[model samples]
Target chain A: MNTALCMLAAANPVGHVTDKPINGQWYVSNVTVMLVLSGIATLWLLIPAAKRITTGKSGSIDDLRTRGVLANMVESVCLYLRDEVFRPVLGDETDRYVPVLWSFFWFILISNLLGLVPILDITAALGLNDFHGTPVGIGGTATQSIWVTGTLAVIAFVFINGTAIIKDPIGFLKHLTAGAPVFMWPIMVPVELIGMIVKPVALALRLFANMTGGHIIVATLLGFVVSLSTALGGVSGHGLAIVPLIGTIVIYFLEIMVAFIQAYIFTFLTCLFLGQLVVHAHDDHEHDESHGGEHAAAH
Target chain B: MQAMRFHLALVYTALLAGPAAAAEGANPFVGTIYQAIAAAVVFVTVMVVLKKAAWGKILQGLQDRENRIKHDLDQAEASAKQAEKTLAEYQKLLANAQEEARSMMESCRADAKKVSAELKDQAQTEIDQARQRATEEIQWAKENAVNEVHAQAAELATNVAGKILRRQINAQDQQQFVNEALAELGKGLN
Candidate 1:
């Protein structure tokens, strides 16, 4: 068999086929399909949901407030991400960046959820890998790919830094000084620069590591069932297979939770990083004063 | 045979993965730059498209609804306060009307009592006057009857005297006889 053919021939119980070099060229992969699919899925769910969440042309607030579960869930998550997550850090500037942050959340979350769906595995089961003697791998976890996650981090980094520069160029420059004394500027600035680069790198690694680790674990456990049952070859083979099967099931459910959590962590950290740039010291002071008054009143 | 075939394939796949994954680098974390570029394009497209499609409308709606709810609560509170004030005013008016009616009733009763007392005094005076007049008329009628009887007795005595004498006596003697007869009638009336 050809090396390129072997790349696509490998099934899910074996490994991720996208990891191989089919033709070893810069071409679209399963990750690309997942990217496009996740985008479409996000749009499909939200486009209609947005209409329900929006106040009707009748100008009735009840229309917005009294919506169905999908609308309510979307609205609540958006609100929690904005008011609880973004507003605390971004302050009044929260609204300006809510679109980007919300996009990050929904896109990443949907992508994460899509990864849990075994599209490629199902395709392999259907024996659709060969297309007229050509091997085509059509599914994989997009976020599990380092390139995909790196791309997301770079986008986040650009938005975070771009807003910082545009919003307050002076403060953004001062941030490079790392709030150290004049004499310490040389060392602190370089350190700050590296830290800035490291922030997005960490984001990329975190998402990639989380998705890759969990999905690979589930696949490996399920692969054990296949390997063990075939190797053992009898009632004991099937009976021993139950252990890895149960393990796969358990990890599969855990992957679902990890999917949501990783999405939240990625978006939250991005928001926090953006806040560090866009929001200022004075803004924090003002926020503290206002919230302090609110806390006192509440008590 | 099947078991051997399956395990052999796993080994086969593992062998195949090593070389291809190492094509870029010995490091597994090494990325394909072009893949990143493609992903960047896709993510940007998704984010930009969704920002327009959904985020703007949802945020604006929440803000507008909050403002409207605050406005509605204020209007409701104002309306409730106005109703309370109007109710108090009406209650005061009602109390004043009740007081006025009670005072009027009291005054009417007082005036009736005063008129009734005055009428009773006037009737009493009229009855006293009628009784006095009746007593005076009875006394005057008794005196008139006594005077008539005295004149009749005197006239009888004069005629009797004239018969006994069968002639004309001295005028002084006749008159003396009649005077004696009037004195005797007055004594008898007393």
Candidate 2:
């Protein structure tokens, strides 16, 4: 087999890796599509939002009370980010970073949904046939790719520390060696670096593993039916044949649910990291406002 | 050094992964993906136009409608004030006319009574004058009639006396004596 065919054959059951090349460079196939779709969806969502905020014209109480397609969509997305993602870990710091976090939440959500669509799954299904040509709109779970999630995580990582550094240039370095002796600096510095780098890596892998794992399980189950049917001359060969079909269908639905959950998880962690970076536990008044004076009294 | 290590690790991973999956040829999705991109651009352009044109007019129309309603209310209020003033003036005029009519009626009643008294007095004077004139004429008529009666009575007596005398005398003697006596009597009376 040619190199391209060989590469596609080894791409696993999910269409994570494909033979499609852009400018002679082989990009991670699904990641490119996810990023594109996410950008477009973000712009589409933000237009009316920008208009609403800039104009200060709002829908009436009737509009808020009822659900039209556009209103419902905006409300649902905003509510999910606020209640589920931002409120939990961020707590007091939630407001400042809520917008960016919400954007990430929605973007990740749409990309995950796009990955599960049947048309995108065509290339993965007809693996051998895909050697002839790349299927239209072919992609798997975007969350599965390390580079995609890692890039997003790295951006969060930089902004978090960057802001903290900018806020208190002197105090920022002091926190790294906070309570340790002079001798521990050499060991502590490397440890802190690992700690910093590991956070984003963890964020990336957690999302990627969860998303990729679900798709792989569904694909493998479907692949079993295909192999069995070919061996036995037909799909309904043995009584055991019904087992694979039912299992595939069940796993397929489970995979879809997992997609949403993973997207939410990724966004929630991002809020947590941002909160840690920006929130200063030192502000007595702010602490009192947020935690009802408990943490302030303790301090 | 740490940042360098991170970049190196990323590059190493890329190099090791080798043209991912190393299979498949000719991707079919590439042909028409650009169309969606083009459509997105058009959609954004349309949004800009709508925001500028349609939204502006709608807001302006709402404000204009508010102003027009306010103007109409003001006009209605002015007209109502004018009507109230006219009504009050009419009421006052009616009152004045009623007073004038009342005065005129009172005067007419007084004039009628005075004129009736004057007519009664005039009629009384005319009746008195007529009665006096009638009484005077009756007295004068009575006096003239008595005088005429007396004159007739005298004429009768004289005639009778002459007849008696003629009867008593003889026929012949009487004729001669009568002539002589009448001549003597006529001369004496003349």
Docking class of 1: incorrect
Interface RMSD of each: 5.2, 13.9
True-structure lDDT of candidate 1: 0.75
Best by TM-score: 1
Interface RMSD (Å) of model 1? 5.2
Candidate 1 residue A226 Cα shift, in angstroms, is 1.1
Over B41-158, each residue of candidate 2 has an lDDT whose tens digit, in order, gives: 3333333443453334323332343455687799999999999999999999999999999999999999999999999999999999898888888888876765454444433444
lDDT of 2 by residue, A1-299 (tens): 25423433433354333223333334434456555665566556655543332222253333223134663455556655765657665665565556556556666676677767754557546652334354444555455555566656666676667877887776567545543588998887677667667767777677666666666666555544543443343323344346777997998788778777777766766665555545556344442353332223222
The residue-level lDDT of candidate 2 at A221 comes to 53
How large a fraction of the reference contact set does each model reproduce?
0.40, 0.01
